[model samples]
Target: MAVAPSTAARSIELPAALADWLATHADALDTSPALASEVVPRLAGAGLFGAGVPEALGGSGGDVRDAIEAIAAVAERSLTAAFVFWGHRTFIEYVLQSPNQALRERWLAPLLQGEIGGATGLSNAMKFLSGIESLQITATPLASEQGGWRLDGGLAWITNLRKEGFIAAAAVTSSEGAPPAVIAFRSDAGGTERSADLDLMALRGSNTAAVKLDGVHIGEADVITHDARAWLPAVRPAFLGMQCGMSIGLARASLGAAHRLCTVTRSGLLGRVESLQAELARAVGQMHEGVADGRFKSAAAPLFRLRISLADIVQQAVMLELQGSGGRAYLMNHDRNFARRWREAAFIPIVTPSLTQLQMELQKQAAAAGAA
Candidate 1:
């Protein structure tokens, strides 16, 4: 990726009013684990959710790249908060891009207005559609009496979901040769089951939980888009690309902590730490370039490699923080919350197109090249 433009940061800048608020509240946000429903209104007041939405739909109207920067900023403050932003943005993208004009008109405004926050099942759905995993959730045609479609089975687990909110769900039809579909539903809808939050190893503050749909009803207006076999490839790149912002922000924060420790200790490892800083700088530059130019659709290998590299870098960054900080990091509330960043590192690899998945995919590509 090209070195960040001199003014490139302007692209991801948060609205002025919001930035002012964040400067004041950044510390509290980093330490606490408040519920999203409590915080979403705050996000709305800042006009934060509309970054990627169309002006006509009450969004501020930037593409995915703009949204990525905005979310990344949130990540630096709180990765949990960033996940909420991404989930909302992801759901909005599905709705706005769908052929369902009526659905877009009905929910798009309120969604951006922060009246609602939602969850995404896209990660697992994409995996199932791509044949990496069996479908955990399945869809069935509705009976004439019930109308609309029925969604059955449970989504394994999804982050950024609220106890009561909207959900953008996708599932493959359990029919031979049938394509998968993306649909919307209320989390509290009839026959839908929302489980308690999982005891996650990381991102526990993200309000993650399991959702089971036992013939949940969805109307024609709720079908965000179908033909998942055809649609997923078109959207996967952007979906994955947007994740880079979060990684960059987390990496930057981790590195900063390491710097603080190194400063106090005046350690010899400063050179090694500086190398990580250089590596992250290079990765962030390349990520933004690839994402802005939509290169993941073509030369995605570089993008994948960079994404995994960031994951690895965050681990090293946190390790440096721990080494430099010494016993202080073991405290329950270390000044920098270095422990949280350490936990945050666990999330990147397991996320879809996870490190293992990335390596496996690369192996497959290598095999294909040899055959060719």
Candidate 2:
């Protein structure tokens, strides 16, 4: 892994060859859903999917920082690819942290190698952890068998639901009123249906879809943890931290593009570009410090705030790029890069745990504290 200068906020960088691959294919991936579905295996072959995973888990050994930086590096070239990367790597994380050794052993290698895809159908689970929503899926006991569960309910939105093969992690409430649990179910399993990709304004290639589980059966072997209340807290830090990398990379790329323009025709915009660049570095620095010291694991509010800040910066950077490029960026030909980045910027605010949702959560927390 290439390391950035100490003064830089993030230390990790993808190899030039991998970076070039992402940049070269970014437009195609953005326009073609068929090509986008192939993103996991393509980047997996480049060894881009395993940065933060442990060697024992069949991954190149590193921590969450490495993972976040790797994703950010990819995002600089292609947010679509970065979105897919986040989904696949986040699932790898679930398996790594899961208590079930057999679950890890059975799935980790294939997931790590990118032979099969992994989906994180856990947006509701994260919200559920925050007390913002209930678990969307439910598990009922199997009267005929000891360790079987019947899952019903669905996720309205999920990414990386590849058509080839995939296993998704979801949280489920139980009919018996047992503590909520996290479980993995495969796509090929009966009664599990993935809808056609949602008609999206951007990220058309992300393989995003909605899924329904009629009576999907899962056994103890599928359980990531029997107590999601406990498991989610432990894993939530890495989860949101890695997710923030998407914003970091997009902001970096947009800022760099703006800076390039400012040097020649748009020198007046230089001050604004520098200000956003500095803010991006500071936000990244805060995230790295929190992840290293475990502050984000115990308290996610700070990370949530940081995620919001980065989203704001990403929007500003993309708009700045547009301003600097002016009429040239509006062209349908090669200069459409700015238009694509603009659409990607629009996605940052609405991604799961959206800016609005985070703002509401903060308000609720404050009101409760005031009452206390």
Which parts of model 1 have CA positions greater than 4 angstroms off? Answer: 1-34, 174-176, 333-336
Position 143, candidate 1: lDDT: 64
List TM-score per model, in order: 0.88, 0.96
RMSD values, in order shown: 3.6, 1.9
Query: Could you tally the backbone clashes for each prediction?
Result: 1, 0
lDDT tens readout by residue for model 1, 1-372 = 111233464245555655565545544444454544555666667777776666677877666666777777777766767777777777777777788999888888877777776666788876664457877767777668867777788876786677657665565464435566777878778888878877766565566778888978788888777777667666766677667667877877878877867877947768878989999888777776776677776665776788788888888888887888889888877664576677677786787757887777777778889999
**What is the lDDT, from 0 to 100, of the residue 244 in candidate 2?**
95
Find the 10 residues in a row with the least total lDDT in model 1.
1-10
lDDT tens per residue, model 2, 21-130: 77877877676686766788877887767777766766676678888998898899999999999999999989989989999889988987888889988899988877
Query: Which candidate number has the best TM-score?
Result: 2
lDDT of residue 353 for candidate 2: 87
Model 1's lDDT to the true fold? 0.71
Residue 320's C-alpha lDDT in candidate 1? 85
371: Cα error in model 1, Å: 2.1
Question: Which residue pairs show backbone clashes in model 1?
Answer: 1-286
